[model samples]
Target: MRFEPRRHTSDDERILPLINVVFLLLIFFMLAGTLSAMDPFEITPPRSASSGEDNPRDIVVLVGADGRLALDGTPVAEADFEAALAAQLTESEGARVRLKADGHADATHVVALMERLRAAGVTRVLLLTIRDEA
Candidate 1:
């Protein structure tokens, strides 16, 4: 009977390359997303509860602290805001709306805008508020 030595396969040798490749892809995507261009406008949503899952909204209406309105990131004049919103609502019946108001935005203005949107056939509106860390 002849006795032979068995080959030993090191698990780390196969896993090290996989880990290196994963890290390289992660770094690449992080850089790519950081450099990606989006709306030039700056908006910071108000924070409150941070636990619940958020519902999807079809249209976005942003209210800047200075009383400016942006429909889906495009600026809409005060006089034209309702018209634009109505048009969007009509396009999608019973449309779900999301209002992203700046943390410093006036409460009255936000309420007024909500009333106007309700009048414009937007029955379902979600006012987005950021979750508080505390």
Candidate 2:
């Protein structure tokens, strides 16, 4: 008696389950992604006594200890800082600005930056700091 060879089955039956798993993983990652505007420069901000809540979409301005200034991670001259801020504010009405200054930064430097923001029509400004750990 002659024995017939068995036909190999295609993997088409397993494709649907694999596709479903991949889709679910994609959705999970999308939802789990943390959305926050982070400063490009690493700064050790001064501690604050106030328990101010942080907004995710606020524009950030960083002032380094050496008086270097950056807005949204882009370095700008002291004279051009106001113009850059104005351009940003023009895009969003009533947009809030957050200032992140190094702990060792001079107080006067921070104050001057704040004044510039005010002059540029940013009415609301928030100072960013790390909350002290108990």
Query: Which candidate achieves the best lDDT against the true structure?
Result: 2
lDDT of 1: 0.82
lDDT of each: 0.82, 0.84
Q: Given candidate 1, what's the lDDT at residue 74?
A: 88
Cα lDDT of model 2 overall? 0.84
Question: Tens-digit lDDT track for model 1 on 51-120?
Answer: 4444444788889888888897788889998888878777766558988899899999999999998788
Superposition TM-score, candidate 2 onto the true structure? 0.70
- Report the C-alpha lDDT of model 2 over 2-120, residue by residue, as the tens digit: 98999886788768889999999999998778565466666889986677876757788999888888888888888888788888888777669999899999999899889878877
Q: List the residue pairs that clash in candidate 2.
A: none
TM-score per model over all chains? 0.66, 0.70
**Which predicted model would earn the best TM-score?**
2
